[model samples]
Target: MSLFLALVLLLPSSLCHRTKAQWHTCDSGFSISATAMARNITHCRKLQTLGAELGINNYSTTPNSSTSIDVVFSALPPTPQGWIAWGVNPGRHPQMVGTRALIAFNQPSGMPVVNTYNVTADTRRGCKLEPSTIEVGVANKAANYSDETGRLTMAARLTLPPEYNVSKLNHVWQVGPRVVGTVPLAHAKTLHNFDSKETMDLESGVGHSQRHHDIGLREAHGILSVIGWGTLLPIGVIVSRYFRGSPIDTKNKWFYAHVGIQILAFSLGVAAWGIGLSLMERSGQYRAFMGHRIVGILIFCLATLQVMALWLKPKMLDKYRKYWNIYHHFVGYSLIVLIIVNIFKGYAILKPAPRWKWAYIGILIGLSCVALGLEISIWFVFLKPDDKKAQTNASDPSKTSNPN
Candidate 1:
C-alpha cells in the first residue's frame, strides 16, 4: 500500500471521543439524572479514578455523561426537540439506515443509568380523558389510543404542507395504542417545536413527512450497540495491518494480543446480543427483521466453532489445521463486517432518532482501522511468511536440514 494510504489506515477515522464538545449537555434537573450531572465533574473524576483503578464503579458524563448518547441528523441538531412524555426510543427511524446518535451509559464506577425519560405524561399514568364524551374524540377516533394513564404516548405528528400554512409545522398529531416508550424522533419533534392539533380543516392522508408511530426505539438501541461493538473492535484490529510498518505478525506479541482480545471481545459480544434480543422482545413487540435474525444465528454458530476450536485445538492440530484456520478466518472476518452492516441497518429501521447515525460513522470508521490492522498483521505474519519460507526450503533443502 502507498505510504499515504498506510498513514490514513492507522488514523482513527472517527468516533475517537477526541472532541470534548461533541455533545451539548446541560442541566434540566427534571428530577431525573441520567448521569447526575449534579455532582461536580471533579468529584465524579475523583470517584471515577478510584473506580477505574479498582475496576469497580463506572463514571458517567451525564444525565451527566456516564453513557454514550447519539441521535439522528435532526436529533443531533443544534436545537432541542420536543418531549416524549413516555420512555425512550432506540431506533432512528424505520425507513432510515445508520445511527444518527449514540450514548453510552454506565460508568466504570458502577453508576446506574440516570436517564429518566418521562414514562407517561402522568409519570405514573393517573391522567386520562373520559371516552367519547368529547366531540373531537368520537370524530377522530382518538379515544382508542388512551392508556391506563389516559395519555396516548404513542403518537406521531404530520407536518402541514409548505403551501397551505407554509409553516413546516406538524400541527396534526396521530395517536395510537399504549406506547410503552418514547420514539427517537420525539427528540427531533421537540427540537423543531412540533405543535399538535386535533385536526386540520382540510384532512388528508399520512404523508411520510407527517406520519409518525410509537416507534420501538429503546429496543433498537440494544440492537445497534451489539452490532456496533462487534464491528469496530474486531475489524479495526484486523484491518490495521494494511499500514506499512505495523507490528501485526503472529510471532509478534501484537498479533496474539489482538487475537486474544478479539476472542474475549466476541465473548462479551454475546452479552450485547442478548441485551438486544431482550430489548426487542420487550419493546419491539417481538417483531424482528430478517437481517437481525440471520445475524444472530451466524453469531451463535461462529461462537460454537470458536469454543470447539479451543477445546480440540491440540487434538486436531495436525489433521484439521487447514480447516481450523479456514473456520477461524472466515468466521472472524465475516463477523466484523456483518456487525458494521447490521449497525447501519438498525439506524435505517429506527427512524426519528438521529444522533445515533452520525456517531456510528465515527465509530465504524475508527474501529475498522483497528480491525484492519489486526487482520493484516495476521496475513503478514503467517500467510506471506509461510509461502516465502516454503519456497526457500524447496529452493535450498540444505537450509531445511537440522543436524540435531
Candidate 2:
C-alpha cells in the first residue's frame, strides 16, 4: 500500500486535475505574463515607428511549431462603449493580405470575450471573419484597474495555426465601438499598421509611443492643396475674366489681382506638394494611391507651365497672341477641372475626419455658384449687342445690311 501511494504521487498532476499552462510575469506593465506555451515562441517584435501612439498598449509573440501572441490594452473596458484589438499583418498596413487580429470586448452582460478577424483593404467592413470559422479558445485573460492612471488594463492570449510564422509578423492594432464585433475596421475609432523596432534575431520587447506627426502632415497637405489650387486658382480665373472690364480702376486691375492670387496659390500649392511627398515617405505607401499621385503631378506640371507662360507671354500686337491665349485658357481650365477631381479622389482615399471632406465640398459648391453667376452676367456685359446700335439698325435696314 505504501509503494502504491508513492507511485501514485510520482504520477504527474496533469493526469489528475489539469495543470495550468506555465506563466511568467513580465516587467513591462503594471502586471503582465507569458505562458510556457508563449515563452517557447522564439520570435518577438516591437512597436511601430510611425503612428505608433494610437495603437496597442503592448504586443509580443511566442513561436515554435505553432505560434502564439500576447496583446494588452490599457484603454479597453470600463471606458463604457469601445473595444481594443491587436493583430499580425503580412505587411506594415492593416489592409494587407493574410492580416489577422485578436479583439476583446465586454458583452452587454459585462462579461468579456476574445475574438479573431481577417482584414481586407477597405474603408468599411475592412476586417471580416469567415462565416464558418470557429471561435478558438484563448489561454489566459487578465485585467487590472490602475488608480494612478485611472485606466483599465486588459490582456489576452491567441494560439495560431501551425502554418503561422512569427518571424514574419507585422503588428497592427485598433480600437473601436463595441458594435464592430469581428470586423473592427467597420467600427474602429482608430487603426494602425506598424513596424516593430526590434530585429528578428534580437528576441527583445518594444514599447510604443504615441505620435501624430504623420496625421498632421496629411492635414496640412490637404488644406494647402484645397485652398491654393482648388479655391484660389478658380477665384483668380473669375477675377481675370469678370473684373477686366470693371469701370473702377480699369488699368490692369484684373491683371494685378490675377497675378497676386496666382502667385499666392502657386506658393501654397508647392508647399502642399512638398508636404504630400513627406506624408508618402512617412507612410511608405507610395504605390497604394496611384491615381491621386498621377492627378496631383499633372496639376503641378500644368500650373508650372502657366507660371512660365506669364514670363514668356506674347505681346497683344504679336501675331501669335491669339494662339497663346487659346493655349493659356485651355491649360488653366484643365488644371481647375483636374484639381476638383483630385480633391474628391483624396477624400475617398484618405477617409479623413468628416469635417475635412464636408468643408472642402462646401467650398467647391460655393465656387461653382460664383462661377455660374459670373457666366450669366458675362452675356449682358460683354456678349450682348449694344442697345443703341440695335435700335438704329432697326430704323435703317440698309445700314444693318452688309453691302458688297
Candidate 3:
C-alpha cells in the first residue's frame, strides 16, 4: 500500500515534467540605461527577471545616433542543440507589425550560431521571413551544460521605422527545440507596448502561439448565447405550446408565461449578441467564423421582429390576425432553429472545444423528446378522435340515421 501511494503521488509530478519538456519558459527583462554595457553579464544580472530571468535593453532614444540596444535571452536548461529568439516590433503582438528577430542556436556540432530575420507578417502558411533591416551582433553567447543555463546577449542598432514609437515598444520572445524546420515544440510571449522599463512577464504555453486574444471573454459570450438564445428559446416554445389551455393556465396565464419567458430570453440574448460583436471587433478575424456570424445575425433580426410583432398584435376578430399569427409563428420557430445550429458552429470554431457543447446537446435532446410527446398527445385528443367519428358516419348508414 505504501509503495502504491508513493507511485500515485509521483504521477502528477512526472506528468508536469513531461509537459514542461515540450516548452521551457525563457527568463526575460527590459531596461533603458545609457550606461549599461552591451557585452557584460553584470548588466543583465542587475536587470530584473520578467518571468524566468530573461533580460532586454532599451532602444536608443537619440535618433540618427550610432547608439544601440542589448537583448539577453536565457534558457533555464542549456538547450545544447536548441534555439532561442528575441524580436522587436512597433505594435503589441509580433503579428501586428514587422518584427526583427535575433536568433541564436546551438548546432549539432555543439557550436552556437547567431542569425537574424525580419518577420513581415503571419500568413495562412506560416511566418513570412524576409531580410532583416537592422544590424545584429552577438556580443556574448555561452552555454554551460553542467549548470543547465544557456545565455545569449545580442546588440542591435536599428533606424526607427516610420511607425515605431518609443512609448509603444513591443517585444516578443520564443524558445524552440531546433533551429530549422517547423518550430512547433516551443513557447512564445509578447510584451505589448510598455511605457516604462519595469520588468514584465509574458505568457508561455506549449505548442505554437498566436496573439493574446481575450479567450475568456469569448467563452463568456458563448456560454451566454447557449443559455439565453439556444436553451431558453426552446423552453419558451415548449411552455407556449404544451401548457396552453391546461388546468393551470388560468385566464391569460399561458400567454403571460410564454411572453415573459421569451422576453427574458430575448433580453439576455441581445446582451449576448452585443458581446459577440465586441468579440469580433477584438479578434480581427471577421471572415473566419462567417457561417456562425451570419446565422447569429439572422437569429437576432428574426427575434427582434418577433418581439416587435407583439406591439402590433391584432385582436382575434381582425381580418389580418390570422396572417399576423402565421408570420409570428414562422419567424419565431425559424429563429430557434438557427440559434441551435449556430451554437454548434461556434463549438467548432472554439479552441479545444469545451465540455459545455455536450451539456447543451443534452438539453436539446430532452426538449426535443418533450416536444414529441406533446405532439402525440395533441394528435390523439384533438385530431384522431374527430377523424374516427367522420370515418364511422361515412361507412355505416345506421350511424347516420336521423333520430327525429
TM-scores for all predictions: 0.37, 0.55, 0.58
Instruction: Report, for all candidates in order, the number of backbone clashes.
Output: 100, 4, 7
Of the two candidates 1 and 2, the one with more favorable lDDT, higher being better, is: 2
For residues 1-404, what per-residue lDDT tens digits would candidate 2 score against the true structure? 34632333334222333222212233343222232223323333323432212112233445444454555644433355455555555454333344565556655665655665555554333435432232333567654434454333455566655444444444555555544443333332222433222112112343322224454555567777887898989989988877787776477888989989998788778777877787667655566577888899999999999989778999989999999999999999999999999988877765777997888889888988988887888777665568778888899988877866
**TM-score of candidate 1 versus the correct structure, residues matched by position:** 0.37
What TM-score would you give candidate 2 relative to the actual structure?
0.55
- Every candidate's CA RMSD: 20.6, 18.2, 12.2
Error in Å for residue 165 of model 3: 9.8
- Candidate 1 at 286: error in angstroms? 2.8
Best by lDDT: 2
Residue 224 CA displacement from its true place in model 1, Å: 7.6
